[model samples]
Target: MSSKPSRCVVLFTLLAVAGCTSSPGKDFFTETIDSLHAKTSPLRAGYSGPAAVTSASNAAQRFNGAQYQGTGQFVSSGAPVTKVTGDGSGKFELNLVNAPIADAAKAVLGDALHLNYIVDPRVQGTVTLQTSQPVSQDALVDILQSALAVNAAGITSRGGTYQIVPLSEIMASTPPVSVPSTSPSGPGVKVQVLQLQFIAADEMKTILEPITRQGSVLRVDSTRNIITVAGSDSDLNAIREAVSVFDVDWMRGMSVALHPLKTSKPEAVAAELDSIFGTKEGPGAKLIQFIPNDRLNSVLVITSRPAYLARAATWINKLDRLAETNESQLFVYQIQNRPAKELASVLSSVLGTTVKTEGQSGGSNVSPDQTPIAMQSDGVTPAPLTGPSPSLPQQDNEAPAHATVVADVENNALLIQTTARDYQRIEQILTKVDVLPTQVMLEAVIAEVTLNDDLKYGLRWFFENGGTKVSVTDVAKAAAAATLPGFNWSYATDNIQVTLSALSKITDVNVISAPTIMALNNQKAILQVGDQVPILTQQSQDTGNGSAPIINSVQMKDTGVILTVTPRINNAGRVMLDIQQEVSNVTKTDSSDIDSPTIQQRKIQTRVLVNDGESLALGGLIQQNNSVDRSQVPILGDIPIFGNAFKQKNDTIRRTELIIFIRPHVVRDINEAREVTDEFRGKISLQTPIQKRRGGTKLQQDLKRLAY
Candidate 1:
């Protein structure tokens, strides 16, 4: 009876202990909390806080070479919705459907519950907006919707496909802008490039960065009318040098309308306009300066007349959807101006579509109106899509044009994605006038927009279509991104390094820098994770033989990169990966040497994960156990007086990080200490008895040292 009772009590005690056990999860949680609080991690991972967005005060913010505040909503096809004039707030939930844009939105936003802010300053007063510390996708969408409601207009997509609200419409309802009574001196060295190729804010930062740091160069106004000149004569020269690289003609000598800022500072717009226009290089004086009286450009008159070509130029914006294919939007400036009849005939003859003379279809309404041919097209009628104005105000007249001047005059611009091959075939039919070119020209602007790892949207002379690519049949082999889990391998034209982002917030990654890793030319990749993605990596070869690299693949690893990738194509792409790590080891003072605590040598290990993309954008960078952090090198711990010096003959490994690229060929880094330690342990085990050697292993030793 006593033995039975004892056994029962022991079993009950064992069960209770197991039920209330605290395992590695809790242990790790406690350890991590204590270590992080104590500044424990040798290489404290770098992280960025959520980005805050607000309207530009006077500095005037520009996006992609266009003046923009935030996204807009589509108004009714032909309905006068309510407009808000005073300071107001509301929401605009972007509805998604079976479309690529929807997929992109999901891929970017994920399931985050809130978004920060999307301020659209349509009113005269300033916009009040800031970023929340814990930003959520819901918050981002909410902010976007709130901006859309500035005008408080009801939006109704024609077919619920896709639509963007017009900034003009929202601003039109805004109260007049109130100018301050007291004005500064002359034009305060502020200028806005009225026209330029699409560029990012970061690029502008790169251009303007040099002057921002100098103490001698003071900004007259942080809001607007920024003047950047050296306080001293000598410093002025240095400022000029720093800005030189950014002054290259991005438009390749195309007419760029530059408006000197209107200010009371030293220089004034009115004072400069006359002298500038008088000069041969001035926008108004130069024949290259493109201005429109009709706010449109006719592509049909390129060879004959090169004047204000806003309407024709507007067509180029239709190619924005092709960015994924590694090609940029097409830009075709006018070389000559031709007769409207001639322009109409050329497009009608080439694209196999009929040209009309009136705004209404199949109508022959004629009037004695002789507005020089303004709009041009490739005879392709765009679908009824809603978006922002495709062309800029190159023309003086802000008045709307009669539809007859355009070939495909629709309310909104319709961008279609296509392939280079099909584009080649279409080019064969058009650029040659009667027939497409048998051989592509060396300088031809062959536009290719990448949609994903596979598939490209391109210009088929005048048609837009989605290009197909090599699909992955085998589901077994795929690449896993730390940022993107559902990532598969897709072949692309150029490597695109995508950091999983939501509402403009990068959710993960230690640090993100432009061109973080290194690879041979043409090394970039793409990845999509979870239900938001259609396929992981899709691949297609570039048809052009321009010799310049067409595709590359670069990917960020989740854990110390250790994944492998196999390109599905033959030889059309390349991939590579790079990693830099810093490691440190600390030791306390020995009893014999009480004066100074001896520190071990800190180690820096750079582990680069190499890949081969073979010219396609679809590839992956895998890291083996050979991982190294950027700061894994030697360092003295933050000591009071005698700190930072590595102890002689002592080794310290602090932290490690990894970077990977996929394409052509890649080199990897492996550590020898692990191997040597294993070898040393094996020798010790052979010498000592089994009981004494017990469970000591090199892997165990390395891990133990890694723990505090």
Candidate 2:
């Protein structure tokens, strides 16, 4: 009895210690031990009563197990409608239908976790869920928030309480947090600050606004080039995608460019474009700056993005067009490769106005009633005038009916005051007219041919048989017969040198003159190869005061080969030549008048067309001479019969022909012109003396160096 009492006292002391350390809530350790005891009671039923009792007593004493089995399940008869029940672990069971979202959130967070919450007035929704298996505490909270999101309401944690608000107002309620990465945090609405790398934040806001949710908020920090967005995860994803596409390296740089205006003034165009696409000085400012250069007629554009620059350029191009109204504008056009006075005259005619040069007596005049002559579709001839008289003066304040052109000789430009439409027409005409004129090189060879019996017809027949296409006009043939058979003939051949070489072998060819000259299109070139002889035209007898006989007048006559040629080159590489050739010489001296001589001349005047690099031959000037020669021995020819033998008499007849060959080459560029010069120089070098040739070579070398 004493031992039993000691054990009881020890056991009572241990129980008091255990009760002192136990938690105030339901005891999980005692409940779990009772559940084990009830489960194993059936397994120990088959043993004898005392043995079982003894085994159970020993187990209870060693392992601290309970003696009696206890119920393993707890049951509640009438629970609250929105009460939360869960196992001791993190798992919980939920079975609620059409429960208020606020109460459901309270049951999960407030009741289960002992946390605080406040629902906004706009947060109104219901949640219905029935789960057979228990969910973890975190999953239950997630489900509650999902149900709230479906009704356009969201919950965010602030301080220690869960604040529930309308989805539209979630961003306003939550404090913004910076997210370095582009991806979103999670679902529902959250405020995230994003720092942009390339694109302007304001521009990105515009791009994201359309795709953003109804309750989302987008703000820009221009100074920092960042964007703060409050949106759902999907909305943030869309913003990220758009930012990725637009905010690239190609869109980052700022560029400046000058765009020259073609018809309109730079100031007017720049002003118009600025009004259309210009923006203020901030993020996404497109037309940062526009500077109009009146001297250059160009607009300078400054922009921060290439795309905006392209857009601005497009608008500028559209606005920089000629104004259709009759508003006068002043424009200066610099004449290139043409005389300003000449260009002004042409433009004046096109504008139906009379423009006078510097020294002229007329003020600038425009016709009020007249319309400018429209150019034909072929761009050459002017259409017939269809309007009223062109002499009508313009009113004081009204725009000039016809454009006025003033030639600025010092600047070599034309100052035109006209309507934009008229100016456009004038500019087109200037573009076509004020250009370098085409040049032609004319080469001529004048030769005198002593005709043999076989060549009595003329040199034309000789050239025709030598594979040359020769044609002569009927008028040329008639003129040839009137003046010792002088005529003009044109022939086409590939090589003029080959023809000349072949002609030299046939007869005694004496080249009187060979000249190569360059002339502008439709200009005249003259070549004279001989002397000017003075003829006594008038004479007076000696005066009564014993003065020598006064010569009243003397005339100069061109003797020998004289040629005047005018070449007109066409676009098809063909030249039309108007040629006047004359070969004149003193045939005899008058015995009665020593000072006067007989002059024989053959002239041919005609026009012929020949291909470029081809030759034109003028011939049919034939002259015949008959002479008698007598020879006798000095002394032995005294006897009558012997005199006949000693004396010799001969009769001779000489026939000669004059031939002129003219070849034209159209020089289109500097290289062709240089080639012609070199060819001419080569010909000169052949005829020059050795010393002169050396000097010419040195001069050519210097010219070559200068050209280079």
C-alpha lDDT of all candidate models, in order: 0.28, 0.65
Per-candidate TM-scores read 0.12, 0.40
Candidate 2 collision pairs: 485-620
Error (Å) of candidate 1 at residue 393 is: 31
Q: What stretches of model 1 exceed 4 Å from their correct place?
A: 1-653, 664-708
Cα lDDT tens digits for candidate 2, 335-377: 8867676666665564444444333444224332221222222
**Per-residue C-alpha lDDT of model 1 across residues 1-708, encoded as one tens digit per residue:** 334445445444543454455355564234433433353224336745323753433122211111213245455443232211211233223323222322322322332322122222332221223342333343444443343334342111222121223333422332122112221111011112211123333454456555553233333333342333321112233444544555455555443332211111112222332343342454444332222222122111121123534432432233322322333222221212233344345533433334555565545544423111222245445322111233211222222111123322232111112233222332332333332111100000001121211211111110112222222122112332333332223332232222111101211122111121222122223221212112113233566755555443333222211222222222222222322221122345555533333333211122122224222221222222223433322456445355535333334332212222223333222233344345435534354333211111122221211111
True lDDT of residue 101, candidate 2: 78
Q: Which stretches of candidate 2 lie over 4 Å from their true place?
A: 1-335, 338-424, 463-485, 539-551, 586-599, 627-651, 674-708
Which candidate has the highest lDDT of all?
2
